[model samples]
Target: MTAVRNVHERVIDAPAAAVGALLDRLSAADDPIFPTPAWPRMRLDRPLAVGADGGHGRIRYHVTAYEPGSRVRFDTPPGGGLDGYHELTVAPLGAERCRVRHVLECEVRGAGILQWGLVIRHLHDTMIEEIFDNIERAAAGGVARPVRWSPWVRLLHRLTWARPRAVGTPAEARLIRSSVDRPDYVDAYRVDLLPGLPRDPAAWTGVLRDAFPVLARDDGELLMDVNTAGLTARASILVDDRHVTLSTAVKTDSPRARAYWGVVKLVHPVMARTMLRRAHRALALAAPSAGERAQAQSPAPERS
Candidate 1:
């Protein structure tokens, strides 16, 4: 069996202590935004100790080792979708800098292999990027840019997860701040509205609505809810005085549900950008400038 290994190291603005503080504060019941976002929230079944069993949703894992602020590792129980371990660590670089590194070493066999191939890989990559994004934002104490997925990457995602899942609505899905907005979403994709387009978010809604099935359009924002390929997620249209941002936050009710959403997430960025550009061009055509309108209205020359 091939073991999939994910190793990532990132430099953060804060010192090791600051990073450690962030890690230490997470309770067993809380989902640490570091490793994975499959679970909306996690609860510690017992105190942090080796051999303790704790995991969220349909997944279960045991703590193999623990080192406050510096290192921690969790291993999945046999037969879980994941059959290995993942570890996280933070180390100081200097008085004002530090590095957070994480590694996942696991192999999925049997039915789990399909989920890993179609969803987990994409979702895992996305969530790790978010961890870096959030850490940068938190350390910087303000808005930080999120990961930008490429068109080719997004295309592969769509091709793999074209079919919809069979699950129904999650037990609950609260409209909350997204990953770019908050950590509620493990995988979030964003596309900036055209620079020349109108500043008001509502101005972009009509064109977007024509392209995507807009769920709700109100004062300053719009919502697009989707359920495709066994995944359920929502994307919103938000704007400031100068620009609009289109973002999606998946709502996964369970591990399997999350897997479904994860597969599509790989392609979400391209989808968002594609939709934005299509709508933008349509808007321009529908409301041509005065000069263009005049040219169109002018009488045609004799004989074609």
Candidate 2:
């Protein structure tokens, strides 16, 4: 068995009260810290309190202790090859300055040791620093320099990025479904619509670019014309509450078109899935940070 104890701390040019307020909002629906969109948002089964059970991504833990504006700790469930807890705390450094710190102490055995040294450590460090950056930006006004993901971290993120899954043509994609009667080819791919991603169908036009003209738009679906090589085709992008689907339908009216499609169909699915996955990641990266979203939503101070 190997024991690991990691600590990261940052001093912010803001009052401890201000910094602690940010900590108290962790796991909130409008969480302004903990770095997200780039990483998974922390979640809890209930509100931030004792017994709250949840964690970000594959990591699982539950709240063991909570002090409204000063500290919170989460302990991992037993028998996961990991034992111990992680916590965040805030302390006053001066009248107008404060320090925020995160500590993770755990014992790992077998494969858990190797995983912690190689993967979990790197990711946890980056996440903690990013969380501090958000604290500075939200409570201290701005961060002169923000943490950047190292090449190794970037590679790991890519390796772990979510991919699109093959799915049957959704019945909700009425535009594409009804566009072609007895269509010669059809395929669909879907990816979960992560929080903060745009729900507007127009924002997903990149899924079928190359100047595909929009033929129609339903509530959450955008239908586009993708005809070429004497073929008739329509693509639909559907953005529902839980998912985003990209569906394609094609009609080959002649022998030339049929032959062309036979060769294209083999590669079409691959391309469609790639495009959807790319767009999903791109939108996620471009989405506003939680702090930025909170600031934007905050009402302006009333004037005399």
Candidate 3:
């Protein structure tokens, strides 16, 4: 077994109380840190107190200890080759300065070591630095030089980004469903509409691009005319509270259109899924960070 201990620390030009207040909101709906969108947001089944259960992404851990405005710790369940705890701590450096630190200690054997050294380590380091960046931005006003993702980190992010899954055309997509009677081709792809992503169907029209004219819009769906290549077609982008779906319907008017669609149908699913997934990720990355959103929504100070 190999033991691993990794640490990251940053000094913020803000009072310990201020920085720690941000720490206390770790898994909050409006968390002021944790560097989300670019990465998975930390989540807890309940509030961020001792016994809270949840972790970001695939990691599974539960809160082991909590100290309101000073520190918090989480421990993974036992038995895995990688077993241990990770925690965040804040200490006052002076009247207007504080040090924020994160530490991960674990015991790894066999494949765990390779996974840690080759992949997890790089991702962890990048994520930690980004967290510190958000700390400085939120608590101390701004980061002089925000951390930049390395090529390896960027590659990993792309490879791990969530992809859309195939789904039947939603009945709610009335525009597309009724646009093509006896359609020659139809398909749909869906992905979660994660928090912080846009809900406006207009914003999602990029899935079919501007070339497609807006045919109609319902309460939550945008229908666009995608007629081209001698085929009559329509595309629908549906945005609801829980999911976003992209659906397409095509009608072949003649033998040429049918033959052309036969060849296009082979790659249509892949293309539709790819476009939807790309749009999902693009919107996520463009959204304001959780910290920024929290700060924006914070109440303004009273003028005495």
Residue-pair clashes per prediction, in order, are 9, 0, 0
Q: How well is each residue in 1-304 modelled by candidate 2, as lDDT tens digits?
A: 9988999998888889887888889998778887777787787999999999999888899999999888999999987777889999999998888889999999999999998888889888998988888888788667788888899998888777778999999989998999998998889999887668899999999876698899999989999999999899999999998799999999999999999998999999889988998888888889977666655666223323
Per-candidate Cα RMSD to the true structure, in Å, reads 18.9, 3.0, 2.9
Model 1 poorest ten-residue lDDT run: 164-173
> Candidate 1: TM-score?
0.46
Give the Cα error of residue 9 in candidate 3, in Å: 1.0
Best by lDDT: 2
Better model by TM-score: candidate 1 vs candidate 3: 3
User: 1-304, model 3: which lDDT tens digit per residue?
Assistant: 8999999999988889988899988877678788777787787999999999988887889999999999999998777667999999999999888999999999988899998888889899999988888887777767788888899988888778888988999988888898898997888899887667788999988776557789889889998888878999989999887789999999999899989999999988888888887788888888877656665666323322
Please, what is the TM-score per model?
0.46, 0.87, 0.87
lDDT (0-100) at residue 18 of candidate 3? 87
Q: Which pairs of residues clash in candidate 2, taking residues 3 or more apart in a chain or in different chains?
A: none
Worst ten in a row by lDDT for model 3: 295-304
> Model 3 compared with the native: what TM-score?
0.87
- Candidate numbers, best lDDT first, in rank order: 2, 3, 1
- Of candidates 3 and 2, the better by lDDT: 2
